[model samples]
Target: MRRIAMVTLAAGVLITTFSLTTTPADAAVGFWRTVGLSGVDAFGFYDTQAAKVTLTFDLKDTKKDGYSAALRFTFTGTKKQKDDVRVVALTGDRLQDKWQTVTSTRLKHMYVQECRGTWKKSKFTIKKCGAWRRHY
Candidate 1:
């Protein structure tokens, strides 16, 4: 009985040691909202497991007249994070242009900041602004 107890204690110590020495894999998945024109808004999520991201920058406008107004999708982060960046943009003729998701093996971050702009044409000019969430 004493021998069995000793063996169990040793096994427990070994398991604890292994667990402490192991490092956890980073597998954080998060999403951000994009508010654009009536039909130009979108949302995206990213995985932070690998060093490279598969869907880094991608946007699509299913609205027949996505170009009727300007749209903007900005990436956001906490104040400590790097400067906010534009992940997707659409305007003028490009608004109606075909845009697809592109995989990038660059940039790795835990969190991202996001904002969207709606295109309310004024005198036939596309205008985008605001940091709010909207369903396209």
Candidate 2:
């Protein structure tokens, strides 16, 4: 009886571990873009389960030209009604990788625009923007 109970416990633990690591069928989808310009890359995913958008930027400019990266998220509701724009920016060292998240719910259509900009007087002025791409 003791051996049977131990075996049963081990089986239970194995099943639980596998289940925890398994990804759900509705797992979030990811997107990535790489700009030919020196040191500009952005990528991330929208997690429907968490109702959040994650944006990551890997920026590096050898000249340290005050270059910054940003993500413009446009969310629309079920009726395709435009909601609002959420902008997340990353700035600091010339070579830096950072990510930011915005919690958005009830989104039917989601679009993201990756932008490269400069910092001027504690403000980020977008110099250029990639075409707005649909994420969801």
Candidate 3:
């Protein structure tokens, strides 16, 4: 009985260790849009392993004519126990209806970050923004 218990405990420990090591880092996703305007919408996501940001913008209400939207991503993280950051900018044109792009960067230490997205349109003067915080 003692030997059997020891073997079972050892097996459990090995399984747990393997599971932890094999687990994939969590991906962060967020959404944003112009507050008063329903026509412009955007989605953004962060991949922990790839350390990339993907942004997609849609010109939902196509009733009007040509318009252009600009998106900016602000990322904040820590590296070497100190502050680190990276910023990327992407633009989407309404003529095509939808636009998406991805950019690569180091997400810093702790696998945690705060990302904020700001969006504006050519015809629309005021800028709109949204934020998401991800932890792993």
Candidate 4:
């Protein structure tokens, strides 16, 4: 009886450890649009039909440092449609890249990023501009 109980406890412990290791991470970043400026409208319009946005994630290494991930977005024109494509990139510590850690995790991929960057058009740069985020 003692041996059976010990084995059962061991199995339970192993199962718990395996479950924790297999659990996914959190990739819930938000997205938004950069509106109002000259190129803003263009980007917005392009956003309406279809546009390509690149996302780079800078994460921490397994040593609890920092790294990155990326994704491409193809927006289909419609009223509040959801984008289903996903991509990611990783850099920094090979033994422990946060990119992969969060890759399996899900994210909120579409929202408007607050303005700090600018919009660049032909011979012009729209200052005080913002970019959009992805909604997953």
Candidate 5:
């Protein structure tokens, strides 16, 4: 009986140790806009193993609206300060489907916003923007 109890305790301890050490699955957050003549869909995920953020965008406009799709990413660093802000605009073929990966060790949280923009003189200007969403 004593030997059986010892074996069972050892097995339990080993299982617990393995479970605790195993890496966690990636986490994701997303938003979409399909009500207007144009549409935009996006998802953001945190890759645990890679220690990075991956953002995917899908833009559609069957009506051929002049406006373009855009995504803005605001990353907060470990010091609780805004570290980086980036804006990506997609037009024509590039607007259909796109994905971007951000690798930054200092990134602690991310704020995302979707917007519609117009191009003029080789510059993209945001005309409308949606509410900001946050992910950590």
Candidate 6:
């Protein structure tokens, strides 16, 4: 009786451990909303087939200051194939493009004294007034 009870307990523990480490089927969805002094822009849609992101930049009044260029981009990072999840980071010239882990803190903390930048590609444009973060 004692041995049978111990075996049942061990099986239960194994099952519980497996369940706890398992991520949900849709756990990799990525979404984000951007807030700046110019206004608020939201972008992203759920995709369970793969991890994807839709981005929107509003250049509404920025053109008059010689920086008016708005863009909407939808891009999916390269998946590992074995896993359906994808991850991307903004670096190099793309650093000014959007909020990455390092750049976001500077923007959010109001450390930008003077921003001198230009958009080389529509996909990489900077918002002077606010910070952006991943919604997911």
Candidate number with greatest TM-score: 2
Candidate 5: residue 51 lDDT (0-100): 56
TM-score of model 5 relative to the true fold?
A: 0.59
Note each model's CA RMSD in angstroms. Answer: 9.6, 3.6, 8.8, 15.1, 6.0, 13.5
**Candidate 3 lDDT, 1-136, residue by residue in tens:** 9999999999999999999867365665555443333334444444445554444444333323333333334444545433333333333433334555544454542222222233455223324333433332
Q: Residues 39-119, candidate 6: write the lDDT tens digits.
A: 223233332332332222222232234343232222223343222221232323321334322111111011111122235
Comparing 3 with 4 on lDDT, the higher-scoring candidate is 3
- Models 1 onward score TM values of 0.38, 0.66, 0.36, 0.25, 0.59, 0.28
On lDDT, the stronger of 2 and 3 is 2
Q: What tens digits encode model 4's per-residue C-alpha lDDT throughout 18-62?
A: 988662442223333333432221122111112333343333212
Worst 10 residues of 5 by lDDT: 28-37
The CA lDDT at 12 in model 4 is: 100
Model 5 stretches with alpha carbons more than 4 Å out: 1-38, 48-63, 93-95
The models' CA-based lDDT, in order, is: 0.46, 0.66, 0.43, 0.34, 0.63, 0.34
Model 1, 49-102: lDDT tens digits are 445443343454446543432333333334665633334445433445433453
Error of 1 at 133 (Å): 5.0
Arrange candidates by lDDT, descending.
2, 5, 1, 3, 6, 4
The residue-by-residue lDDT of candidate 5 on 73-129, one tens digit each, is 777766755478887877653436666565544446767777777788778898888
User: Judged by lDDT against the true structure, how good is candidate 2?
Assistant: 0.66
Of candidates 6 and 5, the better by lDDT: 5
**Model 6 whole-model lDDT (C-alpha atoms):** 0.34
TM-score ranking, high to low: 2, 5, 1, 3, 6, 4
What is model 3's C-alpha RMSD?
Answer: 8.8
Superposition TM-score, candidate 6 onto the true structure: 0.28
